[model samples]
Target: MPDRVNDTAAAYCRIWAERGVRAWEEEWWLLARDIGDRIGRLINAAPDTVTMQPNVTSAQAVILSCFDFTPPRDKVVMVDMEFPSMLYLYRRWLEGRGRVEVVTSDDGITVPLDKLLSAIDETTLLVPVSHVFFRSATILDAKAVIERAHEVGAMVVLDIFQSIGTVPVDVAALETDFAVGGCLKWLCGGPGACFMYVRPDLNRQLQPRLTGWLAHENPFAFERETLRFTTGAYRFLNGTPVIPAYYTCQPGLEIISEIGVPAIRERSVTMTSYLIAEAQKRGWSVFTPTDPAQRGGTVSLQLPEAATVCERLLAQDFLVDYRPEAGVRVSPHFYNTDNELSDLIAAIDDILADMN
Candidate 1:
């Protein structure tokens, strides 16, 4: 977390006390829009293509709800390596409506591009996959995936939660139909600061069924007779804005924007390299991809009782997470140093030996 998060959130609270409910109309509400603009700039998307949401799940729901599965284009292609929340969400949505084809991982570590390409045939309507595997820390060739999806007349819905702050993403260049992510993890923003983005051209072509009053062409005109949706991306604005989340999230985005993904990626590579080397030296099985290009900011290690090991690490003030299927995920950001990773590796070495 950034040092200024407290101050920023405190400022957010002050606005609530001062402006009360009128803040939504008077001044505080537009911060929500600016937050969209800032996050849009990070992903090389136009401001109009982005809309802030409470979380990625809600954003994913909105994107899926916009699609029509009436005709032959009734298949949703995904992978076994995808984050479970939306994966299950899509799986459950396939109840008599459409087919969900899950491309299984060959080695349980990575989902090969060819597998995904094969599954996304002409009958496929949407390919909702991750830019990076959350537990495995494997980075997908998103550009290639997008190209393949478009080739078969399929749209791509990329969940960039694992890659957004750790790697450079150009949605405009990738040409994905829809993208959803949150600021909570690597972006360093707190919860409730998630966003969903659509291509400008797609926005004009598609309309969302799950929408709110703000999505109307003229929300202020209050025309109750016609419930017309807005022309651009505002069509995806579903409900009341998570305004307070806008304040706490703005600073983290600014910090990341100033540093740039390339620079953060450079530092992250160095840190993870050191981690992978030390883990190998200790005879620990590494789960993350060895190639930096195919990896994100995290390095995963396989160990017995990973949850217990993670507890020990947390007691040592070494921040990381434990996943049941993939073991421990050690994520290093711009703020983390090689020395910190070295200390963590040493701790893991001792912890593993002691446990055995």
Candidate 2:
């Protein structure tokens, strides 16, 4: 997490101690919507079209609950490289309602666009794919996927978790039906704060069944009759909003908004390319794409005993992660320095030599 987040958290505590319940009416009520506006600015979306949710999974579930699973439009399409949570949600939730069709990755690194496109036909209802694959950091061809899905009358639910802060995403330009992501990774906003962007037109047409009192038009009225969903993206909210999470997230969002994603992307590309070239020079395999445009801020370098190496690196103050298929995932963000990347590679070499 970024240093500025500490300040935000402290501020949250101050507000909690000082105002207590009264703060909900004075300062806290508009927080979720305000955060939505910040996210909308980042993704080139209209502020009214975005809303803050607890996490990507719940945001996706809300989107999934909106439609009935029957007739020709009953198949949901996704790629194998997608984050496993969505796949799990679709497979379990739509057991009898619909079927999920996952397009497999050819080499366990990236999905073939043609194979995925073919899977989406008139029978397809929703296509939930990642903007950048979580494990490989390989960016998908979002435009082509959106076009193909729309062509076949299928709605697209884009998971932008791996790409949002480091990658430039124009939701307005993509014309996707829904986009979901969290502040945990690239956004540096920490956890428990995710967002969903519904295309304004679609937001008007769909009503989610998996909803709570917060989505009600008159939540304070406490009428015990049929629920009336609030207009715009608040309709996706369930129960009470996570107010503290929003407080912790705002500083990171503000920092990214000030730096601008395009500048961050440029810095990321330079650092990741350097890291990949350094790894390749030592005869290690790179799981992420070599093409700068086809990748995000991370580079997955395969090495001997990758999990152990990751543990060693973290012990030495190098913050990197490892996955089952992707080894030694090193992500270079805007705040990272070029020398730090070089030093990390050097440390890995030292660790491996010692292990040998």
- lDDT for 156 in candidate 2 is 95
Give lDDT tens digits, candidate 2, residues 202-225.
887789988988888888998788
Q: How big is the positional error of residue 214 in model 1, measured in Å on the Cα after superposition?
A: 2.1
Off by over 4 Å in 2: none
Worst 10 residues of 2 by lDDT: 230-239
TM-score of each: 0.97, 0.99
The sequence of per-residue lDDT tens digits that candidate 1 reaches over residues 181-273 is 999988998899999998888888777777788788888898877878876567888677877688788789989999999999999899898
Residue 8 in candidate 2, Cα distance off native in Å: 1.4
Error of 2 at 144 (Å): 0.4
lDDT of each: 0.86, 0.91
Residue pairs clashing, model 1: none
